[model samples]
Target: MPSIDLTINTDLARRILTGFIRSEIGRIGLKRAVVGLSGGVDSALSCFLAAEALGPENVLAVRMPYRTSSRESLEHAQMVIDATGVRSLTADITEMVEPYFARFPEMDKRRRGNMMARARMMVLYDQSAAFGGLVVGTSNKTEILLGYSTLYGDSAYAINPIGDLYKTQVWQLSEAVGVPEVIIKKAPTADLWAGQTDEQELGFSYREADRLLYLLVDRRYTPQECVAEGFNEAFVQAVVRRMRRNHFKRLMPPIAKLSNRTIGYDFLYLRDWGT
Candidate 1:
């Protein structure tokens, strides 16, 4: 496969993302941010950036773990909290989700995982309200493009500073911003289940997926073009098809066009109310 340079100027990206967090939060008339720290690089980086942008006192990192969650997950999350000195709270999600899980005994791991994810999101939003802050998002572009996230769950956010960065870039930026080396090196997982790792679940490594996604989506290469560039034809086709199938996850729910001023169709100006 043709090599793609995913290397980024970490200093520059860090500056831009920190500024983005500050500006986005400021524009909403809020000075604080609440982040769900999953002990993964993505959330760790988001928490770090948020703390830098809004001061440690202004950023709250919430770790929501289920019964089967790893001890390392909590330890890793605490590492970020300690390293950044951000206020944090740990909310165990096992109880919150177990009732539903018990109600549907037949629900498989995927369904259970989704419930855990949404349960964590609920905790973050509740903390957002209690802490008087906006919810900062941690999902990266690669995951978003592949629809790896659960809608209204890990995918929901008031503002996302790292959403445009690919998963490869997320690691680069994380290392640049002093995210724990262990976190940067750990297998990427949501910790929703005992042995659930992201790449394993997706059936492809982030490195492979990110490279192909960069070519196909960022570079607008067709599947045939990607194959010509040395990507496996089947792999290219699969990634492209998945991206097409998940396009809706990247967009707002379609509003049926009825009046001249539809909410999403015509009323699209974010600053129409004069921010």
Candidate 2:
């Protein structure tokens, strides 16, 4: 609504991709990057960037699929590994998760989804330590803004190269970087719940949502201003409300200020480790 051109320069995009990887490496001293490849565009982009940043020898991709995961997903994941020449592992997590779901059959789908996300993170972190690598997050800015990711799950990461881009932008970058067509064209799904699509769950198209978010967040457009520019008032309000409400998830946990400079209170850093 606040006027998005949605145009990307192919040359500039290539530069941005390299720049993000370099910036992350400089900030975190990345030796390697570990990623959970769900056969999705975001993960594909992250893996591609990791391979580019630290070389394929330093990138490890793990595929953790539950019982309901699609076979095509695995195939697509294999394609990414082959294309990027990165080493990969397939750890079917059905055995790990089924037992918990059996105990709590009535667990909300969202809760189960969160568990799945967190389980993958746990596995990725362990792999990171075992291999002396960092966990690269796959979430984009649009999902982060909409609170669409699970806390400590897909949300937690050692480094995130694509966190600043929107959902639609993810596809563009994925294609530019030579991600598989199957993943790029497929419906965006967390693959947590069966038959669940991201657009369907969000109740809005990525184009519409990205536009409104750009206005409200990027352009600093007020709610009334967004509505006047042709965005639905209710939709704009919903997005802004969600962004404000979930601000905590995007930040380090709050620390009590008993001392002069409590951790995460007064001290802030662009580096991951404090020296």
Candidate 3:
């Protein structure tokens, strides 16, 4: 395990998140944003940013809990709503996903979790349409790099403010944003299944996994180099393999390249394309 400090200064984090939302809202011409608050750090941070950028009136916090969700998670999510004063709604997705589970009771943990994520997303989108807002995502960079999220589930959103921050960095930002201390120190779990924690699902702590990820992706260290730097070879390989396998998930859907400048091909750039 690596002993690393992934903390960000309060001032710098506020600047980054505020800038991200301001830029994204302008780009999409959206005046409001809807966020799925799961009582997790990433969602808490994103909700705070949206509230800051769009004002509390324009930010809607939707809490979509399942039958298996903990009371602690529910309370923490409510705490965020109180802290930010964002318009909030609650939808219990247990009934929504019950039929699917009934059809596939033998489905594995991963599949069940994916279904839950997608169900929550569906609720978020519906609320977005009802409120004329965009769905603000909360997946952090560490999860994105390691493919820790499900496609079209937690991965799909109009804009993700914290997509560049690692999991540990998210903790720092959450604290700076005034997220409750209980949420900050709670065991990191997706609350997808009973007794399922994120680190347990990933087979490594975020501290160790995120450090290895920084060395490999941000620092451009090769496998041998990472192992040389005291990281376990097996863990390094696992992270690298996941990054490669899920490269497609990070990209826009592949185009047939019929036009001279296709969206996912040569034509796609973030630069201004004036009408």
User: Scored by CA lDDT, what does every candidate get?
Assistant: 0.90, 0.85, 0.88
- Per-prediction RMSD in angstroms? 1.3, 1.9, 2.1
TM-score for each of the candidates: 0.97, 0.93, 0.93
Candidate 1: how many backbone clashes?
0
Residue 33 CA displacement from its true place in model 3, Å: 1.0
- Tens digit of per-residue lDDT, candidate 1, span 1-275: 66689999988998899998898889878899999988899999999999999999999999888889999999999999999999999999988989988899999988998888888889999999999999999999999999989888999999999999999999999888899999999899977778889888888899999999898877777788888888887787778788889888889999888888999877767741566
Could you say which candidate leads in lDDT?
1
| Candidate 3 weakest ten by summed lDDT | 266-275
Candidate 3: what lDDT?
0.88
The residue-by-residue lDDT of candidate 2 on 142-210, one tens digit each, is 999998889999999977888888888888888888998889999998888778899998888888888
- At residue 226, what lDDT does model 2 achieve? 86
Clashes of each: 0, 0, 0
Model 3 per-residue lDDT tens digits across residues 67-146: 98988889999999999999999999999988989998899888988999999989999999999898999999999998
In model 3, pairs of residues that clash are: none
Misplaced by over 4 Å in model 1 are: 1-3, 271-273
- What TM-score does candidate 1 get on C-alpha atoms? 0.97
Q: With candidate 3 superimposed using the best TM-score fit, by how many Å does residue 146's alpha carbon deviate from the native?
A: 0.7
Give lDDT for model 1. 0.90
**C-alpha positional error of residue 177 in candidate 1 after TM-score superposition, expressed in Å:** 0.7
Candidate 2 regions exceeding 4 Å error are 26-30, 272-275
* Clashing residue pairs, backbone N/CA/C < 3 A, model 2: none
